[model samples]
Target: MKRRPRRSVPALLSALVLLAACVLVAVSAIQRILGERAWIDYDTVAATLHNLHWTDLATAVAGSLLALAGVVLLLAAIVPGTATVLPLAGRFDSGVARGGYRTALRTAAAGVDGVSTARVRLGRRRIKVRIDTTRTRPDGLAETVRTAVADRLDRIGPATSPAVKVRVRAPRRTT
Candidate 1:
């Protein structure tokens, strides 16, 4: 009997990692809130609040973080291959700029000879592109993708150098 190959171990691992990360971040935030409360007990903190109360900033911050954490966890759980984008931390003039950048990079990679699909991420200091392609001449395919990404970067002129990561999977066979 022929064995079937796995479809997406890396994707699964990434989602797990993102979920774990979101949990960790939430834990850290909660710990900070608790620590603040304990360290500056109400007896001591009340004086500061009396002088400069700002409508419960601590609760506001904590609530906001909790809400963000919940959203991140929910996205990580529900979206396949979407966890990596859960905590999108950065500055873009608008959502269009961010989406355009991603679309441009993915399109560039997909235009390469053998790439089946592409995922692109723009970080503060670096760009990462993941390409899924058939395992037909892996070395040559990788080179082709690298060249395509470089060309796209030149055209985009983003302030960071893109690190192209290629995942070559065997093409699915049809009987």
Candidate 2:
């Protein structure tokens, strides 16, 4: 039941970064072997490391930052992402795109009578519909919108139907 998106982008990014680092180090080493100055001065870095104190504020801060970055990358790789599509009831491999489903529900809600504007929010287990109308007597408009939305959801046919809630904004009353 775990429907997570692929982590191709992260894997590609990590590979590119590692490749770049390796290329830089190899190029510097090749230049040094050919009796030329290295792009990154390995001798100077070694000297600096030997002379530096680990208790220094700058060293501690840099180490902390590197450690934090490693932890963040680890978490990003391990965490599962949310599913972009919703599963249908019938076929195991068939599913509907979330954006398309949301658009359909919005259209259904907007098509209802007395609904001037409709906003539909699709959550993991709920669909909330908020509507505004110019009609003064919009007593049954909310229920009508709810029914329309529910019918549309049934038509689309997700594996588990989310609960539909409707709210109607009343027009201003004048004495």
Query: Which candidate number has the best lDDT?
Result: 2
Candidate 1 Cα errors over 4 Å, as ranges: 1-96, 171-175
Give the distance in Å from residue 89's predicted Cα in candidate 2 to where it truly belongs.
Answer: 2.1
RMSD of each: 17.9, 3.1
Q: Enumerate clash totals for all models, in the order shown.
A: 0, 0
* Model 2 spans > 4 angstroms off: 91-93, 130-140, 167-175
In model 2, which residue pairs have backbone atoms overlapping below 3 Å?
Answer: none
Model 2, span 14-125: residue lDDT tens: 7899999999999999999999989999999899889879999889999999898788778877987767777888856788877798899999999987888998887878
* Per-model CA lDDT versus the true structure: 0.63, 0.87
What lDDT tens digits, residue by residue, belong to model 1 across residues 83-137? 1222222365222256677788789988987788878876655567777776545
